[model samples]
Target: MSYEMKPLEFISVKFSIGLLLGISCGWLFPIPQELAILLSTICLVITSLFFLFENYRKGIYFGIAAFLSFISLGIVAITLAQPKLSAHHYSRDYNQDNGFWILELREVLKPTNFNRRYIFQVHALNDSARSGLILGSIQKEDKISDLKVDNHLLYYGKVHPISPPLNPYQFAYDSYMESKGVYDQIYLNPENSIQLKTTGKSLKGWAAQIQLHIKKELSSTPLGVKEQGVLRAILLGQRNDLDPEVYRSYKDAGAVHILAVSGLHIGILLLIIRFFLKPLMSSYFGRSTSMIVTLLILWVYALFTGVSPSVVRAVAMFSFITYALYLKRPTSAINILALSFLAILLIQPKFLFQVGFQLSYAAVFTIGWIYPLLIRFWRPRNRFIKRLWKLFAVSLSAQLGVLPLCLYYFHQFPGAFLVSSMLIIPFLGILLGLGILLVLLASLKSLPDSLALVYNQMIRTMNELIGYIASQENFIIRQIPMDRPGLVLLSVIIILLVLSLQKKKFVYLCFLGIAIAGFQVWNLYLLHQNRQKNEVMILHQVASTAILYQNGDVLYVMTNDSMRIKTLVENFELNRRIQSTRSIPVPNSFYLGQDQWILLDSSGILPPVRKNIKGLILTQSPRIHLGRILEQSCPDRIIADGSNYADDIRRWRRSCQIYGIPFYSTAEMGALSLGQL
Candidate 1:
């Protein structure tokens, strides 16, 4: 096989790369919005002039101008996306400590164990107007007021910053929320807050109404709770009602994408639509009408699915494909993919950081790129065998493309993905087609119970199959560690290897080998760093106090709540590649290197020997006199874990402030390393 390409062929690809790089740079080092705008304008003007001057357009100056323009455009896009840049953003002037906030509920997020979470748009802080998104957590209890999207909320409370992870290598939810333009969170009690009525409506609110209607209609059908949840996710991209166990099963079986209305679902639906309109393609007007109808349905579905990045991407990409097919023109798949990628980023630059957005594009591109190559390797004579081979190729390609990201973000891989994919892909089309018809019928209150039963049974069977695959514990690999550099190196290796095979170039093979070597070296570096770690961390667990001491590759945990901390400890150990972990009872005192620690529990009894007390830890709501303790020990710092009472901690903080001593609260500052403290 041979391939040749001109330098100017992938213009979109080049610009996309430049835009991506610019967005990354802008995120890492944010600039003033005005400066971003000025830079973008200057670069765009220069590029325009270079293009207008035909003589100058042929030289490197034009190239530099164009590159700068793309980069600046990306910077401007991200800058403009920042809510804080807006004059009305709540954080700029809203009083956090004391204020009556008027908030409009924007979206309902999945509920946590104790709270129903929501994204609220700030309307006013007392008399001052405000804007920007804030996270609202209302306690889940009986008689809680029903709050819908776009409903106004009035509350008197302090807005607190989102808490960071309390353990090393744990998820950074604070960063995640910030990326979504939500910085602060508020805790609401029924007594302290009230829902206000709103006359205005938003597109999201309209979608919510439709979703609520669908939910109500589905409830009237024969579909079970889990079945209804899956149907909603497939048709509307709403997963809030999905059963946890069912969701876990799908996740473990690597068929979770079936529940997400991404490219696969959209692609299947597109094929179904095209199939029904096949006879119309015989005439020119019929073809045009079919194309128009297909596009309208696809876009309406995208809107119905909440217009998530993945859905929008799929719709936009296939929209181009549909138009190209309508015109009978040869269009490069990569170019269309890049065009959509560029368009989405130009509108919502923050989406670049979203896991779903990244995974969706990666899977689609790899399938387009690698599936053909893999299918060519096996030419099965039988029709059934050939179709199965093609499905396997696609499954393999997508998995390979997203492997690094999966490891980096989720740290797990389903070894049974192939089996599950084989079972699901061939049937997914029928499932989606039937599911969509049932949804439309149900919405109109015209669905027959018999048809509902069939759809429900199909969903139940699929769920059971996925659950069976997930139950094979030996095939599920968990806690696999991957870092950013490793992800990059692995991606590079995959790309180089593919290029080597496709182009039959020894140079590409040499680069592939180097990439693999670099990956190994990076792994070694990480292992070396982990082996050199030696420190003690006081982990913050609600209603419990725990201490972790690490020496080389071994971890020693001191806490009575072993069962409670099992997952946390396992995640920490796996992330750091610890060789061993030992759990022990919580001791009254411990020593690590030069640091001496004393622990006081509910008994409030302090050790008699107070000299050389490096740190004093209060736990289990100790009732000791903090001022007296400070006078006697005057330790370097006072540490309180989550087990301590809030009121006691506040009093102790005041004492520390008066005495000019450092105070560390695990509840506020997250887990503390004694040495760092």
Candidate 2:
């Protein structure tokens, strides 16, 4: 009936303190001078009051409160030290200009498929700008031809502060960059002459050099391009150079995560270290020394790999567990994890909203809590059976943990992930071991080519096995878009029920029911909500135009280019249920001849076949048709794609005024949506 104070209790206390601190910090963001002083004074007074409480429990509570208050004070101090407007906001209304100019050149992050553009984070130099990071996209053709990390010559680019993309179910590139203090977008001008500054070196530069070294070593070996690429990806998180088709095959087969360096990668590294240190761990000095060495090496690896937030989180948790093991002290996985969370949040409170941070923690927590219970039910008879069961449990737990997130952020689930993971995860350990050995051996000039040849063959066999698994017929890739609220609520309820359940069996059942029922309910709700929200989305198209419309069960996409049509169809998964009405010719009657028009009748209202109607919806405005469309349609509303013609704001406004109808453009209003009339 009463609460007891214990080490475990600190977990809850620390979390509560962190949550309060975060809220206070969020409120004090872009802190006003008056507000900062008031809050700091209040915090000091509260800390003083808590310090005065003489009772041990009360004193401990006060001490914790005071400690957090002091932390908050430090945050305020840091905020005041930096330029007030330096922090980037990811809001849609944020301006793209009014910032200092800087140059950035960084490698792109995502896969470069035929339809997809690659996004990159540019490393800026020479400019002493407040926040010197920029996000930009490179066409696949350009990237394939001209971009080689270190050797590429610099080009002049315009740096502008732009808001993040507005797709709710897609990746929040804005939020991701905001966490790392970037809030601007860059547009490169190929023709602009610029001198390349090669004076200074950076961590990114170092990482790029490492990648080049790895590539050179792999080239000299007998491994083919595909195998070499996969090895680089799995070992060093360098998937940029991988073949597009191979990447897609892995993604479609649900084995793409194998290429990403994640917790499983860290676990493999830990196991290799533990395997070699087992004998030494029996002795006192050997145990302490080995633990220290392993921790240091793991952290060094983390840094070498660019210290992605996910990797840092995994390394910290692993280091804590290893230290506990070395000290011969029992450690609660949950408490240790909570402590790690508390530590990370304390350092970078903004990471609380990062997708990778959330997913990594969710996956690890799910494995820690649910995997044991799952294995308990299917008790393995032998060591081999135990290992098999463990693999299954880990795969199931991680997938379940990350499913909702995958749906929310990526809008797709790799259906073959479970079976594919089971097939590949066991060999991942071997891949890491061999990769480490290969790196070590390649460093030694005297190492035998025969040994390198054998290792190269083994790596090639593993890559081929992965390729085969990915090519399976039953492998499915389905898109399931659930917005942010849905994902957050589902995660909260699952975590809550799992933690509160009294028995392990009941906990598993609760999680299963919640997962199934929650997904169905959430999906149905999303479908219903989407039905009511009729809107137009103007996508970024290279050569042609595409527009999407939704009304009830009918969805219409108007596009001229067949490639654009395919892109829209696959991206929206329109073939699943929506009915396609008819393909119409480019409406030459409005303004320009031979101009393409793709129109859909989702609302069941047919367009005027003969007459130049009172209203003309031109998705984009080119020089040819502007005057004619204005003369003919006398359109009630003209909605145009904003990216290309944003510069024509004055003329568009004047035309709209003369016609006495409203004009709206996407650049000013963000993405446009219209209600079903």
What Cα-based lDDT does every candidate model obtain?
Answer: 0.86, 0.60
Off by over 4 Å in 2: 1-131, 136-158, 163-172, 188-193, 196-204, 282-284, 443-460, 471-477, 496-525, 532-540, 570-613, 619-633, 639-675
Error of 2 at 290 (Å): 1.4
**lDDT per residue as tens, model 2, 232-256:** 7887777777877888777776677
TM-score of 2: 0.76
Q: How many clashes in each candidate?
A: 0, 1
lDDT for model 1: 0.86
Please report the TM-score between candidate 1 and the true structure. 0.95
Residue pairs clashing in model 1 are none
Instruction: Kindly list the per-residue Cα lDDT of model 1 for residues 1-677, writing each as its tens digit.
Output: 11132213678888988899889888888998989999999999999999999899998899888988999999999888889887788778865577899999888888888888999998888878888899988778846776788898888988998988877777889999988888989988877788787978898888777788888999999999999999988778888999999999999999888888888888898899999999998886898999999999999888777766678877887887787778876556666677888888999899999998899889977877787788777899999989889889999999998988998988899999999999998998998888888989998999999999989999999999999999999999998888899999999998998888778889998999999999999999999998988878899888888888888889999986887788789988987889899988888987766667899999988766547688888999987788998888878888999888899999999999999999999998888887532
Give me the displacement of residue 526 in model 2, in angstroms: 3.8
Provide TM-scores for the models: 0.95, 0.76
